[model samples]
Target chain A: MSVSARPEVRPAERAEPAGTAPQPDTWRTRLRRDWPLLVMGLPMVITVTAFWWLPTLGNVIAFQDYNPYSGGIFGSPILGFTNFQLLFSDPQFIRAVTNTLGITAFQLVFYFPVPIALALLLNSIMSPRLRALVQGVVYLPHFFSWVLVVAIFQQMLGGAGLLAQTLRQHGYQGIDVMTNSDTFLLLVTSQTVWKDAGWGSIIFLAALSTIDPNLYEASAVDGAGRWRRMWHITLPGLRPVIVLLLILRLGDALNIGFEQFMLQRYAVGSQVSEVFDTFAYFSGLKTGDLAYGAAAGLFKGLVGLVLIVAANRVAHALGERGVYSKS
Target chain B: MSTTDTVIPAPGRGGPRRGKRGRAPWEEPGSLAGRLGKGGVIAVVLLLVIFPLYAILLTSLSDSRTVNAAGGLVLVPDGISFDAYRQIFSDTVVSRAIMVSTGVTLFGTLFSVALSVLGAYSLSRPGSFLHKPMLFSVLLMFVFFPGIIPTYLLVSSLGMKDTYLSLILPSAISAFNVVVLRAFFMNIPRELLDSARIDGAGEFRILWRIVLPLSKAVTAVVALFYAVGYWNAWFNAMLYIDDSAKWPLALILREYVVNAASLPAGTAGVAGYGHSVPPTLAIKMAIVMVAVLPALLIYPFVQRHFTKGVIIGAIKG
Candidate 1:
């Protein structure tokens, strides 16, 4: 409930007077003073710069006629928006964009409330032991690889799976939800809920913990029933957290689990399951169209950045602490 | 089961009945109605979470003959056998894949954690020349940047194709881990660093000697995350590694579970070891279990650390 006990500020550390500027010192002395932290930071700086940042710069190939074998990213001739033009011309790329947006929208609407519901249900339980057991069980799926999760689902619900097999044994038709395109969206959303809902509830539970116990006591005294109290107090208390999480989810809407979709792509025949990342992976890497793939990826990244910033702005406007302090 | 029965509990009232001497309505003792309601909730939760695991485990343990003959649900194996596991382990290909997976996970975690800790500690400091920009870049990496294709091209063009580095380097330092470690490092008193400085302790020395020891919980958590990420990593392996021998256990498991018809000869050695039993659906399940077993084993030890790590990582990042 308290998040944590207020971090203790030892007296010796507090000895420095407030509102006083640090003493001017020699550059050597200043370097010596900050050197430990700086040195500690060097490995990360070098690693990220070389691996993440430099490779990121390679995305510039999107604007060039880059051929991996013939010339490197820097050596490639500039082609302006040719890659974008190529991407626009591809019907598959258009389908990818549409599918990605559709999946993102589905997850946002259908999958968003699951964690909240789970948290509330878990919160309602009085037995800590039972609550914990349930929590652990539900969270186990999150650790599983998307491949395993999909396989598990297929083994249980596919046409030849346990459920369908049982139906056939009883002289009924076997339902094939796994490879059915019409049910693909529902299938993916359900899988997402199964895999992440419990883990997602951790934040909501943290929010629940912050609700004042005395408020519940007062509500009880007023004879407000469980449903009414949930409506008035619990939901309102969770408003900030829900809004914050929603904003975060909005920021990650484009990222809809690449491996999960990719694994099932063959089964569903790509018509229903080709999202942006998988689309890019197949187009760029599989097809050797490096520039085109880079362009698509860069496009997704820009959209994500804009969404995050816009969400943060909206959160700030709504008078809530966003994911980051604007400073 | 019915819509009306799932009445939303009042938030502030806690539940339908409360303060009944350690008995909430959800768990109200001695009342049939209350007991039934509580049992129903527990049953539903259990069904939703536990049943699939049970079903999978049962199917995985069942012999292929029994599985085929049953023609439907096999809640319990007719006879339990270790043939599946034996088949997977005995096979040279599967064994080699496991070795590759283990190697990647071990090296990847070591490199990632080492880099992340150092970076985080540096970033945690109050001021440094490149601090703001570095921090912003790291955060930006978390939110957006070059997509997977560009990253794949980068790896491929750098001549890392079909090499172990493809798996390790691409995701070496997670931005989330950096943020978590930074939060933990910042929590360390500056006075400690000052005193260490006064005592002629070098920055690296202080970090290794003092900061790391105090930050065990977070370090362990971050290490676990890195390890799990590496262990479960298959996308990179699928994309970059063209050679079958270089496939990690997860990638192999993917082949086993998704494309079981083409059970590679690698898993056949273990099958031979287990009394000439062929790798079947059970073995595929065993491979899945093997792939997931390490994380499951490591998680309980670091469970407490995980919650703390996430809170710190989320709020700080």
Candidate 2:
């Protein structure tokens, strides 16, 4: 919480011999100074209020028995915590929690280091042109829709697909990697790494750029080899960034891509692939239990918010800059 | 080489430096160990990322006989043909979907970038009335969103359902983009704004005339992001637009690749596998390539800006 310590203007602070301070032109001058900014911001205010803030009021319907056709949000029957109660009692909802947590954990353990490792590798490259070319090739996948990524994987690894066909040609059994429930978590994490590791490395690269050249030079002067210098100097320089990104990842752990899972849910079956976002969507939109779904979404949102705040606090405690400045 | 220039200074730092002459245990030049170690990393990266793309390209180019004969994994096309791409282009639904995707992406990117720039500029001001609250609200949106149901309900209530606006308005300005643009705006010197103000140029004029010209890098990156988001968007289209004809390229791609078992009859080619209209591995690959090509084409031009564009905004928010 970077709360500014600036004091609000007191009447005494502006006092000019008591009576001389009362000038009608002062208000006009202040308005003139600020009016352009206010006017410039008008469209955004209106747009956010109408589209974002007003719709946010609809979150209250989570506490009501929301009937879209019968009555509007205001007219809906009050149902207290019944929606939340329903969500808690459901087994599938519990599974969604476990599945989401599982995915996040897997990503943290496996997917998180990929970008850092890639950044290190790219940093080690002596040729700038080759580094840029490799980066271009790698980062291209990040912009692709999950649909295309999944489709590519399926074309290569799905049953009766390229990898399977290759296996048959080699007189080996086909690998069932895409559809198998047991391997879905690994599959998702690997796919995420493939798509994002290069793009994610940008931050680490930025952080790497800020590292003092003197440290490496000093290490070289001390007869330290490449591995020794990298382990001590380079890794230490990257620590703050790693912590910052880790905290950010912790914050977004719950939002492990809705469309990615939803598109492949039918193929892999919801029993394995179901996550909090998709669960909320299906229950709230498809099933017409609006309040129930809203409760689920709200619940996830609250947990995510808490996680982010807590992570930020922890980072601050660890003496790092954290996600934001704590002035 | 620099590696061997200064190696005999000290021994307390670590083991002997791996100069050009003194190769380390890991750097066994011309040895099986070095080749295997370096080769493994390169091979894994290539197999994981490049091979799928290669498989898709080869499959899309190959004839049906070559495809089936090779068991859908042809490193090289036996004989090249553009039949799959030709077939996709001829299909009215897919062609219309492509047009819809293009229109949405173009309009959405323009509107989003304009709004984001304006909003970000205003928010970047030091003492604007709504600055703090607006900034906080935007950050809050990043964590506790109104989620899918409420957003869908809001979209439907606004009567944006099944319309192009449904694809654009609800997501016209992303909070992340706004934050990024605001950060970029903040980096502009306050003296510039003051000078513009003295010259009788309004905020919008200053933003347009000065700020924008200087912000070409970030603006291009953000616009490309918005365009890609619009192009690849399927969730909003899936939820809001009920009409199959209004589907975007991604949704169509999703149907083809994921829901392969449910593809319509009579669409199956002569080399169909069974009653399922078994989407030839080639068609899936073709659709995947089609979906990916737009971003790939636009990315290189904006690649240089990505580091600055993503980092500055991300850090601030």
Best of the candidates, lDDT: 1
lDDT of each: 0.74, 0.74
Calculate candidate 1's fnat. 0.42
Tell me the tens digit of each residue's lDDT in model 2 across A16-111.
343443333354444555566667666666666667766677889999988888877989999999889888989999999999999999899998
Give per-residue lDDT, candidate 1, residue B151: 77
In CAPRI terms, where does candidate 2 land? acceptable
* Interface RMSD for all numbered candidates: 8.9, 10.2
The CA lDDT at A284 in model 2 is: 88
Worst 10 residues of 2 chain A by lDDT: A1-10
Model 1 DockQ (Cα-based): 0.32
B311 Cα displacement, candidate 1 (Å): 3.2
Q: Candidate 2 lDDT (Cα, whole model)?
A: 0.74
- Candidate 2: the clashing residue pairs are none
The runs of at least 3 residues in candidate 1 whose Cα sits more than 4 Å from the true structure, single-residue gaps closed, are A1-28, B1-35, B265-279, B307-317
